[model samples]
Target: MSYQENYIKQLHTLLRLVTDSVEGYKSAAEHVDSTEYKDLFNNISRQRESIAAEFRERISGYGGNAEVESPDLMASLHRSWMGIKTAMTKKDDQAVMESCRNGDQALLDAFDDILQGDLLNNADLKTFIMDQRLKVNEVFLDLDDRYFKLFKKDPSI
Candidate 1:
């Protein structure tokens, strides 16, 4: 593929992942019973919405069409699985938090892949991805710490 096409493809992939995150967090908010967790999930969903918007803008700037429709099927299935897991675990908050943590890790992994790949050689795009990745990593760390504390497990383990 040409350079432009390759970059556009990368942007689309990031866009899809961010969109999936938004939906995933929204689903988490619905599955959890705690008001605090619900609010947290909703807030994160909003943050991801903003990030997805930036991605859309960037894709459009490159003359590529952004997929503004529903997130992909995998994300849908994962969200459904989360709901089922929550039900099976009797609405356990820890289970929901763990799923959220996993989703966040997946997003971070996508960022790492793009950053380490040759297709993202543009300095401006690189900076944008790095900044976004840092924000996502911070969220992941917070969720992970909370998970360990809630389960009374040492993080070092």
Candidate 2:
């Protein structure tokens, strides 16, 4: 693929990931019994929605179509998360937090893949990606801390 085509595809992938994140967070919010956890997930879901919308607008500016649905990769990830939730006692906040930690790590991995790729050669795109990456990193760390506080162990291990 041409550089432009590749760039647009990556953007679409990121957009779809953000959309999937919103849906995942919403479902996670519903699964948790704690009010604080519910609110946390709900707020993150809204933030992901905003991020997805921004991605769509940016892709449109590049004369490309934004993805209307999550990509197969993210779709499978979502299904896997749902499966994990369904197989367990869903009322557990610790389980929900564990799911969140997994999701956060996945998201950071996605961001890292893009940031380390050629897509960042475009300065504007680079700035945007870096900014988003920082935000994702911050949230991931916060989620890790919360998990640690609840479980008394690092989730990354």
Candidate 3:
């Protein structure tokens, strides 16, 4: 495809991921019993929405149509799996954190691919993508620490 088409395609993919992240965070907030986790999820959800809005605006500036698509099948299945796992194990916090880590990893991978691609010669898009990549990497680091702290040692052992 043409360069512009490739750029629009990548932006749409990121937009979809951001939109799905908002929903995922909301779901996690609803399922987690901890008020701290709930509030954090909600705030992250809002921030994701703002990020998606920025993406939409950027897409429009390129004279491309900004379409809001449903989250991909894999993401939908991941959410369902998380819901079932949390319900069965009653490990809401762990399950939600696991899901968050997975989601963050997906986003980080996407950002990495976009940054590495030749499609990002556009300065504005490259800058935005890099900024997002940094933020996502920070989140992944925090989640990694949180996960290790929570489940590193088995209480039964």
Candidate 4:
């Protein structure tokens, strides 16, 4: 596969993971029964939607399907996150928050790598980077803050 193809595949994988995590957050919020938790869930959902849309636009630039879902991959990601969330919950609220932060950080780093690579030397990436890349970085910073605050309350909680 070409670099474009490989990069698209990785970005697609990451965006789908975002979608799954957002759904999990939404579900957890439903079960949370806490206003604060619900607010965070809703914010994550909105952010996920925006990030997914940006990724879709980027993928379409390569004349590929903007959104494709595979049963096996999707199911696997969902199941994996389910276990992750459960284990984080078993630890503490701070742990759960840190997990969310870590996930966002990973995605942000992936995109940054793509932007720095020669693949981004093209006009398409140049145009999009001037706009979308900054926005994505901002979102990453916000997500970090959202989770970091919880950890600040009690480092060991």
The numbered model that scores best in lDDT is 1
- Estimate the TM-score of every prediction: 0.90, 0.88, 0.88, 0.67
Per-residue accuracy of model 4 over 47-154 as CA lDDT, tens digit each: 767767877887887766877575236434544675577565763445445555565565566556666766564666556644555655665587678767766776
Q: Per-residue lDDT tens digits of candidate 2, residues 1-157?
A: 8878878888888887778778788888888888999999999898888888888888888889976654548656764766577458746787777787787688778878987899767989878877877777887888888887985554554
Better of 1 and 4 by lDDT: 1
Best by TM-score: 1
**Residue clash pairs of candidate 3:** none
**For residue 52, what is the lDDT in candidate 1?**
91
lDDT of each: 0.85, 0.79, 0.80, 0.62
Runs in model 2 with CA error above 4 Å?
Answer: 153-157
How do these models rank on lDDT, best leading? 1, 3, 2, 4
Candidate 4 stretches with Cα past 4 Å from truth are 1-14, 27-33, 71-91, 126-133
Q: How would you encode candidate 1's per-residue C-alpha lDDT over 3-113 as one tens digit per residue?
A: 778788888888888898898999889888889999999999999999998999988988899876656566667777888888898878889999999888878888898
Among residues 3 or more apart in sequence or in different chains, the pairs in candidate 4 whose N, CA or C atoms overlap within 3 Å are none
Worst 10 residues of 3 by lDDT: 148-157
In candidate 4, where is summed lDDT lowest over 10 consecutive residues? 70-79
